[model samples]
Target: MDLVGNLYLPEDFDANKKYKAIVGASPFPQVKEQVLGTYGPEMAKRGFVFLAFDYLGMGDSPALAGEFKQSRYMFRLIENTWDAVSYLGTLPYVEEIYGLGVCQGGSIIASAAVTDHRIKKLATVSGMMAADPFQWTDKDVAHQMIAAANISAQKIYETGEPDYVAPFGLNDDQSKEEFVSAAAYPAMAGESYDYYGRDGFRGPKAVENFSNMHIGDQAMQSLFSLCEHYADKIVQPTLVVYGQDAPTAICSTAFIDRLTNDPEVSAFGGFSHVDFYYKPEAVEKSADTVAAFFNK
Candidate 1:
């Protein structure tokens, strides 16, 4: 689909020189301008080229033919990663290519890397690699999520218009002030909301095409994107990083345990899963750690 992307080059980018490159897979429903935006420059500053793109149906990339933007079907996202790796190979200056995934992006890259050895190494920051949370953890919630996805899909078929909802069980109508003042961030009581509703840090005011809603059918797609089921098959050197106190840390910890390789882990204190997205300290430390791992 000729996916849209933003490639961040090192300050002294030289066409004649071969440099290691990193292809970043972003969290679910996020464009290249969000988490990738925060880390791309940092990776570039560290002497690497970073490629961040919108998955086929998300962000600025063209949606699947006849499908809606933000459809974000899981299988297509993996194919998009493979296509991104192909794009990196086209650059004569790119030496080694690596994969970096944030949140669900981690799962996406790993699922892609299973057969695409073109990606030499792998790294995941606050990755939600395990599927149990969304698939088997609670049968009732899983059934409920599946039901909602079915209804959303049928609505589109019946009305020929996309249905958007706050996937994280957020009130799509709430004001930004209301979200900022919120005492607790109930991390997706349902499945997802658009790219913004989770944290006040990056909301509608922060970027274009920003919204608290996404296609309601995404809940069904996430079930097929998990990586832990095949983590043992991955032989590439891997580095896993996450906020120690983050509720979702289990996603990373459990994933690393399933890896066949003796993967490295960097558990930083005082940062949550979302902190690595843009918080100064979290980004600084996490990026440095990821850069070091890729450099090694």
Candidate 2:
């Protein structure tokens, strides 16, 4: 599918003057409105053209296959990214291209950068390197979640239909309650839902929006496998950012260890995973670091 994107040209953009470019991938279930929207313009203000787009089946992009095709969606992500790079390369003013991804996007960009030379520099914010939370931080809970996911996957395979399950389902009231509580700012808890719920940063779409929440189980499996398989193959300069307090932070070491070059890892001491998405400090810090790295 041909993915759609918004190109943020520099304020002083000139078609005849060559400039570097950055392709931003959004977080899971998020379109360009989330972090990419925030960072894309910010990078443009700093003098680089930035492109942010929705992945297949999410945001404004075309939908994925109605039925699960094993790792098809995961691989499509890499293909679509290269497509974005190729398109940007076609622009007369674009000289070099870079990549930045957050959460799932982080892993996807890494998967693409390994084999595609168009991405000259790479950066990941709160990137999830493994399906399970880094180590056994919450093994029992992780096991429960994994089992639940597998059961959902089995349902899809057996019925020969994609299981349309909500990311936060109503079947488990207790789990649903926790999921709801966790959707807010760290201190707002139950009282606020800013980052990714109704009227959230992701625009009109809510978590219940099928386009934002639907995912094939096989796609999940393939995503994890790709991250593991391509972790070390990326040879470009990489900047890894994570919150010291986020659960995904545990996997940063593993991701860095696999890099062939000396990867730069930045840790935000008091920030959480959600902070990197909209928190002013976290966002500025991440964007500045990324801009600096790419400018080098």
Candidate with maximal lDDT: 1
The alpha-carbon RMSD values of the candidates against the true structure, listed in the order shown, are: 2.9, 4.3
lDDT of each: 0.83, 0.71
Cα lDDT tens digits, model 1, 62-165, are 88666887678788889999999999999999999999999999999999998899999999999988757635678888889899999998999899888987
- What's each prediction's TM-score? 0.92, 0.81
For residues 132-199, what per-residue lDDT tens digits would candidate 2 score against the true structure? 44534567755665676788788877887766544533121223246565553444332224465445
Badly placed stretches (over 4 Å) of model 2 are 64-72, 130-162, 168-192, 203-212, 216-219, 222-225
How much does candidate 2 score in TM-score?
0.81
Candidate 1's C-alpha runs over 4 A off are: 171-173, 176-199
Colliding pairs, model 2? none
